[model samples]
Target: MPKAKKKNRRKKYNYNVDRKKLNRAFRKRQAPRIKCSQIRHAWDRTKSVSQNLAEMGLAADPNKAVPIPKFMQPVMKMDIDGPEKKSKIVQKPYVLNELEYQASLPEKQSQTLSRDLIDYVQHMIQNHGENYKAMARDEKNYYQDTPKQIKSKINVYKRIYPEEYQAFCTSLQQEKMDKQ
Candidate 1:
């Protein structure tokens, strides 16, 4: 059998290839030729970055350019003082006193009862003489502008008929007064 042919090393075959220039050309090809202004217009019209990119004639797979929002934290422009270092961010404990929390929050006024209506309801509850529930139901059905007009009228009826509301304080007062 013939001996295996040795690989011929030729000086003419050696040539200097500039990797930097080749890499630069490759990067240029990868970059879009579209103008920045056109891209901006597309973004402005769509009101979104990815949506604008989609219309800008770039072959973009949304899955590639940007990851799913759920998997990613919001991008924040944090200045790096040194080399990239990550520290666990601990959330501050929510310490709230009952009074503080209540004070901080908005106050909720009674829906149907005004200050006058509340007094009227108390009076009706105290007397313990009539069916205020029916009257209340009627007022609720008939009256419109609450906390101002209708609310007061409804309370007056409640004063005449306390049983309608099932208000416990009214029942106790009626017993205390020997009206029950």
Candidate 2:
């Protein structure tokens, strides 16, 4: 009979490393403990607002107290509704030339295509529907984008956000049903 093979026992590896010790290993040194007291006994019994004021020598007297300050007392003495004050009309300091005035005036703001093509397409569908040409012709829809670009953007928006497009189509159908 052949001799039996020798049995070898493997040692168990421990992966339970101390996290706190590991964190402090790379640090400058062990941090100093907080000097503040966790439980404060001095503030256990607190004083009221009136008692605090009296202690600071700022106690107010009700009899001598005025609702308005002395500075505002003079302004309040004048009656607002008594009579309107007379004033002279001031003339223009310099006459404006037509050309200079025109040049100085703010330029008209031009509309730019929105980054959110989905919203733009949804708005166009609600307002314009399948009439791509008429939609492009509208001032609100134009916004630097040509008819072809607008159509392409609409197609892209539909492909990317199918759920929103489906909802929009359903809403339109419901509107038509309601109208009928």
lDDT tens digits by residue: candidate 1, 1-180:
766566454456325888789898997797545454434333443245444444443424757545565746567857678687554232211212332465699876444546665555555444433455544544433443433344466555556546656566555766778953
Pairs of residues at least 3 apart in sequence or in different chains that clash in candidate 2: none
How many backbone clashes does every candidate have?
4, 0
**In candidate 2, residue 161 scores what lDDT?**
65
* TM-score against native, each model: 0.21, 0.35
Our model 2 lands, by Cα RMSD against the true structure, at 25.3
Off by over 4 Å in 2: 1-115
* Candidate maximizing TM-score: 2
Which digits, one per residue and each the tens of the lDDT, describe model 2 over residues 84-114? 8554232221222333566699987453345
- How high is the CA lDDT of each candidate model? 0.50, 0.61
